[model samples]
Target: MAYAMLEKFEKYWGDYSTLLAIVIVLDPRYMMVLVRLAFSKLSIPVEVEASIKEIYDTLVKMYKF
Candidate 1:
């Protein structure tokens, strides 16, 4: 049972880890500090970085309007 749980954790960790990190980074108190920390910790790709930048730009634009 423990082995099975560990296997499941590994599988989901790939999907959920980034999402969880993003949630933490989105916190107003931490913001870019958390984002930099997450990107440094995780093996984030260039494409993912570009996507994140685009999303941040869109949110900023929305706030301006």
Candidate 2:
């Protein structure tokens, strides 16, 4: 299931990245919350929270500077 989601994400990564970039520009904290909700909906394990946090942190850094 996770692999399936990852495949789909890869297929649409460009679009998703663009959207995330825009959203991060508007508000990175909110973007992180949205990412968390998205992963939760996908049934990502709580154990992967750190990985998600890293992604959110990177996104924040990209938008902040």
Candidate 3:
């Protein structure tokens, strides 16, 4: 399941990356919401949620500046 989600994320990352960047720059709170929704939609496990949160948090912090 995690592998499937990663595959799907990898496929969309190129397209979503720009939008995510923009969101992070303009509004990090929204980026967090988007990340949470994406992960929820992917049915990510609770164990993996921490890593996803970490990644999104980093992205938000990196781009929010």
lDDT of 1 by residue, 1-65 (tens): 99999788668643434445455657888876766555545436784576457557755765799
TM-score of each: 0.42, 0.38, 0.36
> Model 3 — TM-score against the truth?
0.36
lDDT assessment of candidate 2: 0.60
Say which candidate scores most in lDDT.
1
Q: Best candidate, TM-score-wise? A: 1
Candidate 2's clash total is 0
- Model 2 per-residue lDDT tens digits across residues 1-65: 99999898767642335355346546846655666666565544773485476676776777799
Worst 10 residues of 1 by lDDT: 13-22
Q: Candidate 3 on 1-65: residue-level lDDT in tens?
A: 99999888778652334345345545746655666666566545793476465666766777779
Per-model C-alpha lDDT, please? 0.61, 0.60, 0.59
Q: List pairs with backbone clashes in candidate 1.
A: none
Error of 2 at 8 (Å): 7.1
